[model samples]
Target: MYTHTKKPTGLCIELLESQGGLISLEDFHELWSMLRKTHSLDHLYPLPTDTEEFHLLYIIISRDQEHGDLGIHANGYGIEDEGKYRLAGFACLVVPPNERREKSILSGNPNGICDTADIRIALLPAVQKRGFGRFVVHELLGHAFDTLRIRRVTASVVSPVRPSHSAAQKKQIGFNTKQICRIFETFGFKFEGISRGAVMNTEAPEDDKPVWHDVHRMSMLVTDYFEEHIISSLSTIRSPCHKLPLKTVRLSPWDTMIQRQEEEKRDLKLWAEAPKDTLANDACDEDGENSDVETMLGDDDVDEHDWDMANDFDD
Candidate 1:
């Protein structure tokens, strides 16, 4: 389970397993419709029409409010007394279509040790910017690395369309690629590169032609989790701030490595400079103390005379 303190109120928020199939077909339909109607899923592939065929790997986000409270409802699915937790949204992790177990086995990874998976999140509009997304992602990564033992976890964002493109084309893109990239990067995912014309935007078409958009791919390896201490660092963050770090794009693994090396060099330089600064301060303090003693002993006048004579000789 993932737990975090909600911002602004400091209330606790938890992501719990939906027990007893709490989310019924009608609930899923309503939630899916809302997301699609709001263009929230425009960056994502169409979910399966056959609800049973679609994976129900959901983690229900809940607030600290009492159960059955008259708050928002996921079509009546969220009000059930499941530990007195109010539902906010759901998040899930699914195996990518190309990285299924059969494909992994065929690729000589019988244990699927080298396989990768994808993460998906959906939240109510009210809770969108409230750090629930980050909390869910943190928990998902922990599960992927520690529980599922997956080698890599990937996330894709719909790249922004060019302004020169028709208005209809721009409307097809929903997510801000830079914002999404920053989120994943905070979790130690490196950019894998762009997938050209990866998904067709069926919602909008011009001249009866399919509108295809590029997708930005990013992934975090199991090694990155431990090497970067992502899990440990994130665990200490009780309420993740909405202000994300500065944006940067690492287009490939090589770029990521180079950035790491540059950061290490900068750190080493700072460390090396620190001691010199301390020693210089010490020398200045000693000189000041000696000068004060000389001034008290009437040697200051002689020193000033010598200083003036030295200046005259230089002239």
Candidate 2:
């Protein structure tokens, strides 16, 4: 009963843009608050204070397709729908405004083609164990690569520990640290090493006692992605390499004759320049086998300029 839309990935995923008409900001915030209460990590990963930031967020909703006949839209097991789509999970992709700076020294400098993006994902407890989390990650990465042309995507998480919001509720209910790490790994992200004691957690019982977290970072490259998913995995009838199909080449008889004559003339000129025995080597040399380091930054005539601004501690 899942209505198939354009975005309809394998898991019946419906990605509603946070800035769009699918859902309201107040409702999204309320669902996030409920999520906070279940696992509640205010000290380690707190929700953004400004509602304006929600524009960068996406709401991952799950529908009760089987029961659509009854007009029922269950969010997940026991959670009340209350005329709202069941909030299954959410994700955010942070692209810094500067576009030149790096998220961390570990993420490295922008390689010009694929910009780096900071990734964050969260799933509701009721829908935690299902494969929906992986689908969400796939959708996000696909958007980053196809739409934004980003080359590398990264996500960092603090060392997992039980979280508590208040003295009364000490139980933690969300995905643990190890589980979270596995989700990223399943999507081809490599472990990029950790930043030791990068962030502090001050929610310990005693006000004087504070906990420090060594943030673990992960990264994925666009080339590695194409190699893994498209090249190694799938088969094609036209090209064995599995790249995009080439446009068909069609030529009329007159054009073909003219092209042959042109090719023959070029071959005669090449033979005139060099002996037939050494023509292959000369062609290789002309093809830049002896060329110096080449670059795609721009034409060589363009002059380089120095960066005038000092490095700010941002992104």
Candidate 3:
């Protein structure tokens, strides 16, 4: 079961898993389908359709009561045909493994034990300047820190360091990117690093070297966000709807893929070094010494039990 919280603006936040419940599963599909086509303010990046590989990908949809106008879609200025309950905007929370090697570039901890997550938010262009984006993000943080008890939250912002091709493109880049970084900064996230060519430009050819753009990573520790609550010795501050049972989802396939990749890399390393060691060792060397080589070459001794222990967390 998921939880529901009413925001000060009369918008209700429904915390849902991949399989949604507060809204019909069909509605959730419609939201994601729309999001896939929507671009950022600069029309630079769009949500990728293939998201099955990511674990702990949860959708946070902000909804408001139906009004005189159904309102405009976030992607375009055209009015939506949908009913009273307008889907104001949506955000995504991605939880990667604490020890993921690829993510170490962002977290700076190879064997980090703290629970951490990344956030990506998108609000309709019509609703862009109304503080809806900030609200959506706060809800996500509340869930991460209060419910999931995550220690750190990180977000990526497109940096203006990349060269723009046209005058129009330059203007779009300056406006949208700054707004993105500013929003996160307002929530106490600190500037971490600049990742060169980390973001891909959808308009450019995939093979083009410059298709990638620089991105600034920002992070907010839980201690910084909830400092006031702790200082007051309050049991729990009612920032996001209080004390809701957060849904837990276990994505086994993603975890399996990580384990498989780790094993493949380890095996390759062992085999690549085997040839060099065999040539240097004396033929008269003890059989026990040669046993180590045999163990590396023998696939039968590969431990399957160890792989089973690498389980993905339920978010």
Candidate 4:
């Protein structure tokens, strides 16, 4: 469990493990419905049709605050209530299907190393733009690197694209490529190039054809975390580049095949012919014009009272 108190507003935020089963399925469904209504689901990959699919992953639940001065006991749990400690949102760590090592560790294999996991986070519209996302992510990274001993953590953000007709009607969702990059970069995550046509744009299809959008991939290694700490401590020293001493591990056969397939897909020309209006800005192009990108939110420098409808959605 992790707890944070926001200044001025006195809003207390807590991150709890879903293993406690404090939230019910029915309540979870209701929260999902709210996100959909607010179009917060626009940037996320489609959720599993079966809600129960979420049960298998490691989940961190964000809530309002401690129940009372007593606070939640280490072993005890709190039920959602209107007065306080309501459900805010959640962050989940999902192991890839092909990731046998992490899967084994998650399944209680004594010798397995939990080396990697994909992270996703979503917050309710009401609680967004208040530094909660940053707090949650900070605690999550500490837990992943220190407690879970995960070597690598991966995250992806949908690159900004021209809004389709349907998308134009709904409120914008998620952060733009620049905002997301800034957020993760501040946390020591390095850009890992873009995945072309990685996700379907279900909101706007052309002539009954599916429209795909590009995704920006980013990752942070445990070594990167240590390097960040060292750099922070050495405030006066400036290093042009720092390299890891560890050698890259050989990929497994399955991973090699998957990498090859991804390379092949990137080389294909079909995705390039996508309509101009629907095309996404090249996230890799540092100088590319990103007029489509939205203004960033949740920055400490920004006015705390200036609330926006925008929320976060990760996959």
Best model number under lDDT: 1
> TM per model?
0.56, 0.52, 0.51, 0.55
Clashing pairs in 1: none
Better of 1 and 4 by TM-score: 1
Q: Give the per-residue lDDT digits (tens) of candidate 2, residues 175-229.
A: 3554565667656677777677677764553346556666777788887666546
Per-residue lDDT tens digits for candidate 3, residues 30-50, read: 665555455433322334454
Worst 10 residues of 1 by lDDT: 8-17
* Candidate 2 lDDT score at position 194: 66
Q: Taking the tens digit of each residue's C-alpha lDDT, what string does model 4 give over 239-303?
A: 56663344335443335678999888887866776766744665424667553444433335767
Instruction: Give the better candidate number (1 or 2) by lDDT.
Output: 1
Q: Which TM-score value belongs to model 1? A: 0.56
Candidate 3 residue spans exceeding 4 A from truth: 1-6, 15-17, 20-38, 41-83, 98-114, 159-164, 203-210, 228-315
Instruction: Choose 2 or 3, whichever is better by lDDT.
Output: 3
How do these models rank on TM-score, best leading? 1, 4, 2, 3
Model 1 Cα lDDT, one tens digit per residue, 1-315: 223323433223332223346555555556566666565665554444443322325635455443333223533444444444434556767664454776778988765643677777766555566677776677778778888787888888776464357776665443366566777787788888888988777655667777777887888888987866745456455655754454344354555678899999999989888453454345344545544455556653575555444455563
Greater-TM-score candidate between 3 and 4: 4
lDDT of 3: 0.57
In model 4, residue pairs whose N, Cα or C atoms come closer than 3 Å (at least 3 residues apart or on different chains), thus clashing, are none
Q: Which candidate is the best by TM-score?
A: 1
lDDT per model vs. reference:
0.61, 0.56, 0.57, 0.58
